[model samples]
Target: MAFFNREDIDNFDKIHRINLMNSLSGYKSANLLGSISPEGQENVAVFSSVVHLGSTPPVLGFILRPTTVPRNTYENLKETGFYTINHITQTIAEDAHHTSAKYDKGISEFEMTSLTPEYKNGFLAPFVQESPVQIGMKYLEEYYIKANDTIMVVGEIQFFYVKDEMLQEDGFLNLSKGRVATINGLDGYAIPNLFTRYEYQRPKKIENSI
Candidate 1:
């Protein structure tokens, strides 16, 4: 058996861990980048770390640093309870990376990324029109971690839009042709391959079919 100690793991430091995490995109799930804008003008950061927490009641979440660095996203979500999850596809990867340029307030990153902001259902948070899939979220809870200042944000999914072709008859993601995007780090994005797919019910009867 192989074992590893949490502290003994050499890549445990923040910078090292973050860099190590960058390598996980190739193996783990890829997610959309999310951002929040106060009054629709704050050019905040773009995060590739967004994740879907659930579909029942539709939960979504992301992690953010807890520093007092004046994060516009935290403020916007706090004030408006609204944000946009923009899928980062292969084509828009460069622009998505550009969104992290640390722009000042009132500067629209959209102006430079060529991604038009979109609004739906009278909600003002604008998602990227180019995304094959986009979702609107409302903040629900914020939980803190003791070891670090990072916080986990939970939000409710209010609206979702996806390309018609991306859903199969079974209503699951047709990843084989979703034309979606995934990230590897601060600057890597790609559509991964389709490997084997199978039902995951375990504790099975033995068979020699193979």
Candidate 2:
């Protein structure tokens, strides 16, 4: 196996380093974050960093790169205090990926892409109408990661609009059944299926749990 130390990694070409580091962490959830400017211009962007932060409070967090550049999603979220996280499925994965394209300010990605924007229950932000699982969130807080100039934006889950049958009685989401797409690297898209579901394990029973 090829070994890359810190110096070697840092010296690698920018694109090479990005691909290597991004894929090194394995599959990440492919999602589209939808936000709207204060003026009502809708914006949607593909993201792979959405992670569950807490269950009791129903919080989720996503990492946003530095704001040195114009990040419409970040700016819109801060301005509106709301956003939506829509799961990328095989049907809309291509359109979802295109949301990552840098559009001119005030341009709506929904118009540029085939994906449709949907609003529900009077939520201020728009949701991807084609997505099977859509989550409406309220901005909670932002924490800066000093190590990487990125910010972890946390939000509270205010509403969920998932297909009824996809949700299990135990609250587990059968994402595999929905053909949810997972991101490999920056541009790689993959659809994953469920192999098995195992129960939670404790120390002594861990070995034979599955």
Candidate 3:
């Protein structure tokens, strides 16, 4: 196997280095983050960093690029204190990917892409109509990671709009059954299939093998 230290990685070609670093961590969840500006303009952006922070209060977090350029997602969430995370399914993968293109500050990605944005049940933020699983969130806090110049935004889940059949008896949503897709590297899209489920392990006395 090839080994690379910090210096070796840093010397790689620009795009090549990016792909290596981004993919090194393996596949990441792909979701469409929906937000609305204070001016009532809607915005949706494709994000791969969405991760579960906790379950007690149902908190979720995602990383954002530095505020040096136009950051509609972070700005809109700060302005309105509400956002939505919608799973990217295989059916809408192409449209969802297009949302990442940089657009004008007031331009809505929903208008530019084939993805439809819907405001549900009085929620302040819009949700992707094409997503089978949608989560409404309220902005809670943000921490600036000076080491990377990126910000981590945390939010509390306010509600969820998931298809009833997709939910399992143990409260786990069968994501693969919904055909949700995960991201590889920066732009590769893939749909994972259900393989096998393992039961919780329990310790038991066993004879030693020498």
How close to the true structure is residue 4 of candidate 3, measured as C-alpha lDDT? 90
Sort all candidates by lDDT, best to worst: 3, 2, 1
Lowest summed-lDDT stretch of 10 residues in model 1? 27-36
For candidate 1, give the lDDT of residue 3.
58
Any residue pairs clashing in model 3, and if so which? Answer: none
Per-candidate TM-score against the hidden true structure: 0.81, 0.94, 0.95
Q: Could you tell me the TM-score of candidate 3?
A: 0.95
lDDT of 3 at 156: 99
How many residue pairs clash (N, CA or C atoms closer than 3 angstroms) in each of the candidate models, in the order given? Answer: 0, 0, 0
Question: Which digits, one per residue and each the tens of the lDDT, describe model 2 over residues 1-210?
Answer: 988899999999999999999999999989999999999899999999999999999999999999899999999999989999999999998888898888987889999989999998999999999999999999999999999899999999999899887899999999987889999989999998888998898767546554
The best candidate in terms of TM-score: 3
Model 1 bad stretches (over 4 Å) = 1-18, 24-38, 42-44, 206-210
57-175, model 3: which lDDT tens digit per residue? 89999999889998998989998999999999999999999999999987899999889989879999999999999999999999999998999999999999998878999988899
What lDDT tens digits, residue by residue, belong to model 1 across residues 1-210?
Answer: 855566645648787677665774453334434454554573434676577788899998888887567677777777887787766667776776787777676676777677777667776677787788887888899889778779898999888888888777877776546666666665666787677668868897888896
Model 2 lDDT, full chain set: 0.93
